[model samples]
Each structure stands twice: as C-alpha cells, then as structure tokens.
Target chain A: MSARNHEQWTSPPKLAEGEWVDSRIYSDQTIFEEENEKIFKHAWIPVCHESELKDAYDFRTMTIANEPVIVVRGKDMQVRAFLNVCPHRGNMIERRPSGSFKEGTPSGTPKRMTCMFHAWQFDMKGKCVYISRQEEGYQDRLCTADVGLRELKCEVYFGGFVWVCLDDDIGMTVEDWAAGALDCLAPSLNEEPLEVFHYHKAIIPCNFKLWHDTNCEFYHDFLHYHNRITGFNDAYFARKNSGFKNGHINVGSFEVQYDNYEGFHSREELSFPHLPPNHWYMIDMFPGVNFNLRGSALRCDLMTPLGPDKVMIEFRGLGLASDTPAERQTRIDHHNSIWGPFGRNLHEDLLAVTAQGSCMHPSAEKRNILQGRHENETIHDENGMRHYYHEWGRWLNRSPSNPDEEFDEALIAAASAKPAEVQANA
Target chain B: MAEKHASTIEQIKDVIYKSCLYQDDLEWNSWLDMCSDDYHYAIRAFSPEIRADMEYMGGGLEYMKSLTQMLPKHNTDNSPLKRHCTVYKVEVADDGKSASATSSFVVYQTMLDGINSHVDAGESRLFLVGRYNDKFEISNEGVKFSDREVRLDTRRLDKGSHWPI
Candidate 1:
C-alpha cells in the first residue's frame, strides 16, 4: 500500500527458470483454502513425538489444518488419534490440550473421554461408553457403536515422532512419504531414545507457508549474525541439498564450531549419537514438519495454519532420555542458547517472514519468491525451496511458475509419482 | 546466622528495582555487575503445548554472562522494553546471608522508529506479565541477585527481544 514504483520492488522475483512463486500464494485466500483441502488434508504430518504420550491414557491435543485432533496412548500401548469433536452435538470431548483419561471422570467413572457440555462420555479408543441417561433416550437407536469418535490414521515412527494423516484412505505410508529424508537423523533420534526438554508455542501473524519458506531458504543465512559467525563456514558452503520423494528437504550435514562464535563455549561435552559435537542438520518436511539438529541439541517444530494469516509453531527440544541430571542441564542450556524463544536466530527468522507478510494482502498485488541459485554443492542454493514448491504446486494443482494457470489433476499425479526427481531446470 | 542474613526488606527492594531499571535501559554490563558470582538467571512459563509447567529458557551464571556478552553481536529489535516491577515479599533466610523475593512484573515494548517520535513514542504494548521469583545473596558488600527465575504466566512469546526479562 505504501507508494512505491511498480518498476522496481513490485515485480515478482525469479528463483530459477521454472521456480518463481507469486506472493499471492501467501495472500490468496482461495489458494490457501485449496491448500488446506488438497495438501494439508492428504499429507502425513508428525503432530507429536511418542514421548509426549508417556503413559497409557496420556493424550496430547493438537490442531492441524484447523482441525482439533487428540493423539492418545491407549491401555493397549498403541497411540491413536481421534477427531476431538463428539459425534452427538460436535462438542469438544476434552478441553485441555493434554491429560490422562486414567485420571477418570468427575463422577469417578473410570477412564473415559467426557464432553464437558452434557458430559457425553467415551473411552480411550474413542468408543462411546456412557451417553448420559442413554436408556431413556432412544435406547436402541443410539448405541455406543453409532456414536464413537471419528478415528484418524496414526503411526509412530523412529520411536521418535507420532505421524498422523487426516486422509484415512490416502495411498502412502510415513516411510513412503518421508522416504530417506529423515533416515540420516533416525539413527541418532533413537540411538538412546530422546525426550523433550524444552517446549514453546508461537502464534505469529503470517501465512503457514511463510515459516517453511524461511526454513527452506538458506540464502538468508546472512540474516542470522550468530550463524554467520559459527554455522556459515567452508563446510557450510560445501553442504549439499537433497530432496525426497514426498517433498521433504535436507539442507545440510555440515559442521559448525560453536566455540568459534563469541561467548559460546566449546560444545565438547555432549552430543547426539551419530552427530559430532558441533554439527548441524536441517530437514523441512512437506506440509508443516521441520526438524533441525544443531550442535549438541535436537529441535523439532511444526506449524499449521490457524487462518489465512495466522499460524502457530510448537517448538520442542529433545535430548537423550538416559542423560544424567547434569547432562540434561547442559542440553537444556545449549538448546536455549540459539534455538530457544529468546535465542539469537529463531525470532530473527520469524520477524523476517512477518515483515514479508506485512506487505502482502488479498487486495494487493502478488509478490515473488525468487530462489534462482543452483550451487549444487552448497546450502546456499535454492534447491530446497524449489523442491518444496514443486511438491506444493503439485498438491495445490497449480504451477509455481504461473499461479493463474488452471489446476490440472493429472499433472499433480504425475509429479507426485516421482517428486524427488521434480527439480528446477538450470 | 540471622544477623548474617539481615538485609532489610527495603534494601532488597532497591536491588530489585535497580535490576529492572538496568535491564530496561539495556545496560547489560551494569546488570551483570549487580549479579553475584554464582548468579543464575532463568525465564520459565507454563506451556499448554507441553502440557506441563516448564523452563521455556534459562542459563547459569557463567552461561548467562556469556549470553549477555554475545547478545550485542546479534541483531535485536530496536524497540525499547520497559519493565514495571513491584516487590511483593522478601523472605530473609534464617542464616540472613541470603533472601528470596517475589514481585509481579509487567514488561512493555515501545516502538521508537518512524514519525511517532514524541510523547506518543512512549506508549507501549504489554509484552509479558510474570512474577520475578528471585534469590538474593546479602553480603557486607550489598545485595545481589543469586538466582532470578522469571516465571511468566503468558506463553505466547512470538517475537521476544534478545535480552533476558
């Protein structure tokens, strides 16, 4: 809205020959809604790590694609997800984000998911148990089988994260979805079983894609002063970018000497099993999953759209579950140093996307995501962004190069077949 | 032991006020000067996401010292943060060498850029509300913060500044 020459800043930037995305992708409500349906709904998103559900009946509530979902561990020791809504009047069964059903009900009626509205009770398997005076109300008409909570496709992987898919019949497994994207870190994640040490939520004013864009764009490493001092080195520049079959991206497996940065002590104390003390790895999965291992700590965060312009990032820091009290403390300290909410880098990343979002509006003109670099052997390339959009464009049924082009389903299916091979043409 | 810990409540209040003032003014060095040798500063908040009360962020004395030292090298928000702290209770230890103090504090961030550069520039938006659960080591030299845990009631720290609250 600020008066600026259209000749200069208004034009969309080009990333590569075929990798330019208009800013309308962030500002367009129609496109955003379509994304929620086609992309977000069908994709497998890791909502919570299994450690979050420590005990039987322990549950964690999360909202993905504006849908409230509850992932709970049952007495059978299986983690299952149910649509948090009740089948009767659509009231949310459990209001608290997380708790144990084993705590029983207010009337002390064993383990049941009870709706606070009319106290409609259901068991951990989402089976409708006591429908509050069911005998008097249409007895035969309303049995537990007819009123159970809707179940979702849920899977636990790497003994690490709980992956869920809103699409029940979606033709893909988490292994097929991630393929080799998370393979590098899987060994390390489960080397000794890691538990979350730090967790924080940030609801920022930006489109859901803006956060992922920030993660996929390595050219913006200059924006982080601490990264400049420590993370960006000869190894950093030599780090290669790889993409997987389901649109997951891996930016690096590089080394970063934390002691090289001013005031940061040498990270010689503790580390993940497979990684060196001062190493860095970043993985940006499709939809809304990002896992990054930097130095001696592991940070996994996911964001989903709250609205067209609002998104929430739930950040978690993981450390060896078998770590001693002193080791855990060190992990906590190191995690907070850079990856914490008060850290030097994350807020900076959020602010940059926030600034980009401030310029976009549904009524305003489209913006550009120019990711033209193809260094091939460095994290500085835009290949990560290119691969991300390649999957996004496929899912959204649109072309990244041309947003206004009519969506083609066949094109989407074709690209989905070999997404890893989908890349920007030099 | 009581005599050794006998720093007056009024004296403790001054240390709390001075610490808040130093933080608000972005005087990192001066703030560190007031911290005891083993000073540990921490910020904690209840996380619904984690479903537990947890430390969102914090560090020990040397770690905090390094944090403050390294902060200036990073890019922080130019906006100024003003902390309003009220000392509620000061519990002196039986030995009197140390005391625990609690205060309800509110921090506001005021934008200092652009045309809004007058009395209007002073207007601020409430950024955080928390209680300062602090420990002070009262010595012959003075009272210094040994451990300050800012247990924040709010968890939506979307874009917080570089410095500790």
Candidate 2:
C-alpha cells in the first residue's frame, strides 16, 4: 500500500475527456481488490457452454473472479452451481476440470460431488445428502440442509453459453447486454450455428483488461505479424466505430475486405453476407468478457482476473457447424492462423501487455485513465473505463468525480440522501 | 441415416489423395469442386492440457468459396506453398458409403539466396504427426469429402500453420 505515495492515490488528474488513459490502473492493487468484490463478483461471467454439459451429473469446475465454483447437471435435468469449496473441511469438491457424477449409490455406484477431504456427499443440488458420521457421537448436531454447498446464480444465454454472476442482481440481462452487438453477431451464430472447435487457453502476465482493451481498439492492426498475410494495410478498412448498449460496448466494426482469397470472392463487393462485412465488431461486456466479431469468424474472449495485474485469457474460435470437413478446415486454418494462442495477432497483444506490466513501476496509482475518443461517440466511450469505474464507484462507494468522498463517506452520504428523496416523493 | 456409397472403398482413397495433391498444387478450384455440395471441413487441435474439449474449424461451401477468394489476395510473406504429403491407414466404413483415412505429412520451405547465395530460410519441417480422419461419399464423377477432422497427435503447434497440414 505504501509503494504508491498518497498524492499518487489521491489527487491524480482525471483522464482528458477523450484522450490518453493514465496507465496506472493496471498497477494498482487496491483497485484490483475492489474490482474482484464489486465487478467480477456482481457481473454475470460466462463460464461454459451448455453443450459442454450435455449429460446428467456432468460437472465442470471453474473459478469466477477468483472464487471456485462448480456447475453440474442434476438428475432432474437442471444445470446448477455450487461453490467448489467443500463445506466440511474447505477442500475442493470437484477435483477434475470437467466430468460427470452418479445420482445415487446403487452399491457399486459412486456418489455425486463426493468431497475427498471428509467424504461428505452432496447431491446435484449441492445438498449434503450423505454423511459418514451420521450415527456417531455427532448424531445430534447434523444440520444437513443448512450445510449444503453454497450455490451461486447461474443463467443460460440465448446461444447456450452458461454465465454465472456472483451477485444475484447487478446489471442488465445478458440478452439486453448483448442486443446491439448480437444484431450484428447473430448471423454468424445463426448462419452456421457455430460450435467451439478449438479451446485455446493462455496464461498471460497482465491485467485481463489490458489484453481485452487492446482487442477492443484496432489501432494496432499493423503490428500483427499476420497482417502482412491479411492485407489489412488499406487505411479505409482500418476505420473504427464504437457503440454502447446498457453498460456494454460494441467497438471497431469498420469495414475490411473479406472475399478475396484465391478461390473465394475476388473483390470486397462479396464481403457483406446479410451482415456487415469487413467490419470488426468488439463487444466489451461490463467487466471481463469481450466477444469479437471479425468478418471472417467470431472470436470469444473470456478473461478471468488473477489479480488486478494478471489474467487468464481463453480464446474460443467458432465456424459454421454444418460445413464440410474441407470447408471447416479452411475456416479453422484461417481462424487459428490469426487469433489462436500461438496466432500472430493475439501474440503481439500478449507481448505488449507483458511489456506494459514491467514498465509499470511500484509508484503508479492510476486507474487506467481511459479518456480516449470520448467525444466522438455520444455515450462517451472514452469514458468506457470510466463507465466501468462509474459502475465500481456506485458499487464500492468510490468516485473519480469526488476523490475526497472516501468509500465510507460516499456510502453514508448516498444512504442518507436516499431517505430524503423517498420523503419528498411521499 | 447412413447413406451407402455407390463406389468401391478403394476408389474413394484415390479421390482423397487427389484432393490433397490438388491443395498442395494450389488447385483451389478443382479442390473446391471435389467436396460434396453439403461438405463439412474442420482442422482441429485437441490438447491434453484441457480434457473434454476439442477445438475445431468449420465452414460450408459458400463460406469456403468466399475464403478461397480471400486467401490469395491477402498479402503474406510466406507464399506459394511447396510440400509433400503421405496418406496412410485407410479404413472403409461397414456400409461402404463413407471411409476414414489417416496420413503423416512434413512441409519444408525454401527461401531465396542471401548475400553469398546462401539460403535465407530453407528448412524441411515436421509440420504434423497426425491422422486425417475423413468421412467420404463417392459419386460416379469422383470422391467427395463429407467431413474431415485432422487430429494432431502432438499437442503444440509450431508458431502457426499458414497452410492446412
């Protein structure tokens, strides 16, 4: 906490209305802690697609905003979530990243979610159905129902992807959150009903937003080694436009030529296919997930925050589900060539983020002053970072507007002001 | 529904071989025409690190047509691929309507000579050690690929693959 001086934390300059970001947001530990509690916990984070959890009792364990959670399809055919922690001894209930569980022991069958620590058995709904010490000296103190594994709120998106928000209510529904972007992205999701054929995971060293923000903006298009291959050099295709829906954003869907491959369309005229072609549409959801639509294919970016400074990025590639093997290979070959973990484009972003982290010394206290391109758009997306901070400010009671309003003071003032408005309306 | 193949299983292998040879020779039009009208193509990378997950690439004929138009126009430092492929382990489906084929392949790149006429970048590479599992449909004209999954036995891909292996 003492690494950054009081002035660095306190009276720092607000980012210009629509200009450069302050760059210190990635380095601050305090902001990171608040984000974990306020943003990641409250926002609905996409964990797995329902397609992955096809069978009964199939379970997959993942950590959202650092809290371990397990998703399983119960015998009754409901997808449920439970804190991955075992209630009895605090060990993980599901050891494997993904698999299935037995509904009941038929003498030879294994129990669902059996805790390795104390062998406490939990049902698909996370209830403590069986206990080893039920009849022992502890026979009187067993409150099984109350001690079930803690459940988190889980919901399914239109496309069958499962999202878990730690807090039951925080922002708009995922549908409302993705409406505009979906209007443009739905064709890809519908045209082929694409499925994730490649699940590439990279444990990069930097804030998830750094990796994502880089993706949100296309100013770095020329830096990609594969750009030489994609012919993105034309300045006109490089134009970018951004929009907002609820608290999310759709950025950089500027037109680019897509139909000029050796055997595909020869000119850019064939680029548009009921949906805008050559444009790159990036939807940055409230907190961590960014769904990018490059005219060629759809790229889903899930950023799991490790700390304020580190994040794990999983890149999911999608293509037409009904295509022939050769056609699908062509899509995959083109898709993986640019965005996979080893792909040329994202590798540059990873390197850039890693280098940015090393440059951020201990003295930095900035919250990523994101005031760039603020005025160009009506919603002030340069304030997109601010919009996130604004959401955070409302949640944790902090403010970039009034720096003097301490977390405690802001909460008290807002609490006191609420009753006055209620009285006046009454 | 299993559709029975009208042609013998042996004939289908030759079609599969011809498709690869055509792609290696940059015969995009001929290769495009070889697939069934409703063909499905995918190149998947399955990693042991993340079990229960298979990542794939998919596109239909129209999409492939569009992709073919775009691939050559894209400015790439590595252009005009030169490599050889070997197809092995041919398996005929019980119905003979479809067959699965496996192959091993290596791709080498030869670069132009430098100052002393020494090659700038020329090397024979072990591109992939995997089997190509293809589901094929044979017609009187030729063998068409219904579905193909390139299962790479090795987990890590070298840098990136410009051409499909």
Candidate 3:
C-alpha cells in the first residue's frame, strides 16, 4: 500500500447563475429556522391517512418540526388534529404514536382524551370536557366552555390522507393546496379503496429538504444499479413531470419492465384498475408529503424535520381494502420487495442523502444542483427538482439559485398568469 | 417427555441444525434442497410502536425462488454470515405426520473489509437476534422443511443486510 501519497483538498466549483446552490441553505441555523417557521409551520402536511385511524377514537401522535401533533378520530367519525399540548400546564395529552382513548367510555365506542398531568381532560372532538376541581380554582371563570385544545386547520382528500396546517389561515385547503396535481392522480388514487398496510419510519441523518430532494430528483436513477438495469428503457424516458401551482408535482406514470431485471419476478397481476399494467406514478406535494403508486400497491412518504442535520421520514404502504388475504399478501410482497424498509431502490436513496450530508457537513461547501436537461421534459431530466426549488424560493422568499436576492417579479407574474397545464411542469 | 421424543426428536433436531449450517455456510443451493417443493420461509418481527407483528422479509415458494435467484445482485455487506441456533423445543403433530419446532438463533456477520475488516478478520459482529419457527414434514422419503419463519427481537437494522439473516 502506498502511504506516501496524499490527495489534494478540492473545493466545490462555483457554477454560473441558475445552475447551482450554496450548500449553506442546508445546515445554516438561520435558514433552518426560517424553514421551520415559514415553511413547515405554514405548509399543509398530510400527516396520516383515514385508514390508519379507521376505528373511532383512534389517534396518531407525531411531531411536526418541533410541535407535537395529535391526529385523532372523534366518536362522530371526524378526523382532527390538535397541538397535543395540554392547555392547563402544557403537558402532552396523547403520548403514544397510535392508540385509542379508552378513558371516560363505558361502552368503549368513544371516549374523551384525558391527560395524566393534573387530570385535565378533553373529548375526542378536542373540546374541553372536564378539569379536576374546575370550580375551586377559577369559580366558573375558566370552565370547559372557556378552554379547549388548540386546533389546527385540517382537510381530507379523496386520496384518504388527513392534511393539517399549523398556520391559522392556511390560505387554501388541501384540495386547493395540491391545485390540479391531485386531480391528475385522482384517476388511480380514488378508484381503489386503498388502506395503509405497512408503516415504517427511519431517521435519516440529513436535512428534511435534503431528504425530500431525493424524491423529486429523478436523475439519481443512475445510482440504483437495479433500477438502472430495469427502469431506464424508452418507457421510463417518456415520463412527463407535471408541475402545479403551490409546489405540487405529479410525474406521469409509465409502463415499467419489472421482468427486465435479471433476478426479480415481473409484476403481472392486480394492478390498480385506473393504471396501465406494470405502470407507476408519483405525486410530491410541496414541502412534506410524497406518494407513488404501482401494481396493487400505493406508498405515501412523509417527512418531518428533527434538526438542521436530522430528518425523520415515514413510509406508509397502502393496498385495496377489498383485497383478499392472498391478494394482500401479494401486495405486501410487491411493496416490500421494492419500497419496504429494506427495499433495494429506497435504501440506496437513503444512503445517498446521508452521504451528501456527511460530505457537506456544516454546509461549508457549495454544491450545484444541475438542472440542465431539456430533452422533451422527460424523467431523465431535472424538471421536477427545478420546479420544486422555484416553489421553495417563493415560499422562503429567496431564490434557490441566488439565495441572497428575491426571485424576479416577472417570473412570479408569468407563473401566476399562466394556468397550470400538464406542460407547466417544466 | 424428552424420552418420549426418542429418535424422532433427534432426527428433527438434526434437520434443524443442518438447515442452520447450510445457510451459515452460504450454501444457497444446498439449503434449498433441504426444503420441500412447497417450502415457505419468512423473516418476521414484532413492532411495539404499532402494536403489531411486522414482516421484514418473506413470501411464497415462488417468491423464495425469485429471492434465491436475486441473491447475487443484492448489495449486501462484503462479509460472511454465521448463525448459532439452540433447538429449544419440538411438538409433533397428533397425527405423527408433522412437527412444529422453535429454536433461538443469533446470527453474527464477520467484516472482511473496511478499516477493521483485515486486522479483525474472523471477529464476528452481532447481526441479528431472533428465533426460528419451523414446520417439518416427516415421511418415509425424508424430513423436509415445509416452513421457517425467523421472528426477530430487534428493529433498528442500520443500513440492513440485503441477504436474509
């Protein structure tokens, strides 16, 4: 082994305008804080689906940015999200990830959410129902009618996701937030009665946006040797990356050659009725949620920032509710084979993002996110990521290409004037 | 009860040991032979967070066939896997035609690359801790493994092993 030779320190080369970005946007405390407040707080996030909260009184606890959120289904069967922080002493009410509110329910059909701290209780509807010794403390000054859990804006979609926004005035509902992007996917997503069959979460050591970039950037297909062997034919190149207003994107489905891979079996049966056989489609909503659908399976990916250098990503795989035991097994088989926790392609993506985080630690170096391809606006290009950064600029009030300056007014005017058509994804 | 098992227990235990040995030796083809035509193998674990049992890997016999074929392409660690199993108990079916057995297994992976791969050669790293739930079919022809589901006690698989553990 030659121990005498030493490699020279090389810096990330600066590229021309609109070609690269300063990596400081990833680890800079100020930028991360701005993203947590200006983006994560205001953005409409699809936290969980209706299927996960199928039963009455079912609840799921999660943290958005740093805020603990409790998404619960009331006895009336309405899905709602609360701050999860008790109003009395600011203690967490529901401490578990997914559980039922078994308190105050004689029949067990429905119950009130009770807090162990001070015994302050709230109903599933998030209304303050009881407080221990309420009259003794305030003497009717503060009673159940006067106090309740801090509620957030929530809207459900035909796709079965419960979308919540921390912003008081969420400008638009989930339907409008997705604009027409969800509409484009409605053909396949709504036709089937999809239920979440698999849920797994992993903490990738990287920024939330960094992890999200992997979803929108299709050029990384080269990194997956398996995908490179099976996913880069003519059909793959023909994919159209369709962009919508408010940072939503839907990469049109293309027929895949699962059998083309040397070692894997082909997906031959039980494709969603609306989709072409052995085809896949992807939908990435602005800041938080991502979904991909293929034969007999649908996966919803959601991410919440733990820190500037840490991201918690969750993947929920969905299959039709009407699926037989055998059909469900096949669906799990197909989903786990490709998108499960130990999936071939997905693990590679995770490893790549973490590697990027490692090399660009503390965001000392600048990296160019080359968005150069213009070849018929297909999957081989960077149109999706370009559109995503453009939306990022709009939300963060800074150009991704040149973060110091604001995006040109003319570009904003052009986007707002031009109605979002399929071609607009470019 | 141990005496009641007699030769049957020894025979079943021997089959279990051989299966573990074949897998640890990375003799994929030989391990396949030890299984029946309808062989079913699954890697399962329980997740307390979701309050449900989880399957990390597994499928039908056809899925197994495809998985076996796909082994060479997986980007697993450049290391070797060795398993140590202790046959805990065996309960033969009432008809004396089949038996279900459980065994505690610990799979250790040896790192043969990276900084410590060469210097610490043969030093096994803890890979997986689990139990094997096996179903055996005893017949005049031979004792073939009909099913083997490994239920793991751990969840966080850092980078994870591409090959079955």
Q: What are the lDDT scores of the predictions, listed in order?
A: 0.79, 0.59, 0.75
Tell me, by TM-score, which candidate is best: 1
**Candidate 2 C-alpha lDDT tens digits along B108-153:** 5443221112323464445445567777775556567877776655
The pairs that clash in candidate 3 are A243-A425
What value of lDDT does candidate 2 attain over all alpha carbons? Answer: 0.59
Better of 2 and 3 by TM-score: 3
User: Number of backbone collisions per candidate, in order?
Assistant: 7, 41, 1
The order of the candidates by DockQ, greatest first, is: 1, 3, 2
Cα lDDT, model 2, residue A176: 65
> For model 1, how does the per-residue alpha-carbon lDDT over A238-300 read when each residue is reduced to its tens digit?
887888877898876776777777667766568688787677788999977899987678898
> How much DockQ does model 1 earn?
0.53
In model 1, which regions exceed 4 Å deviation? Answer: A1-17, A407-426, B1-7, B112-123
Per residue, candidate 3 scores C-alpha lDDT tens digits across B22-121 of 8877777777887888888888776544555667678656666666677566544456788999999998876667888999999887866412344556
Higher-lDDT candidate of 1 and 2 = 1
The C-alpha interface RMSD of every prediction is 3.1, 7.3, 3.3
For residue B139, what is the lDDT in candidate 1? 78
- Top candidate, metric DockQ: 1
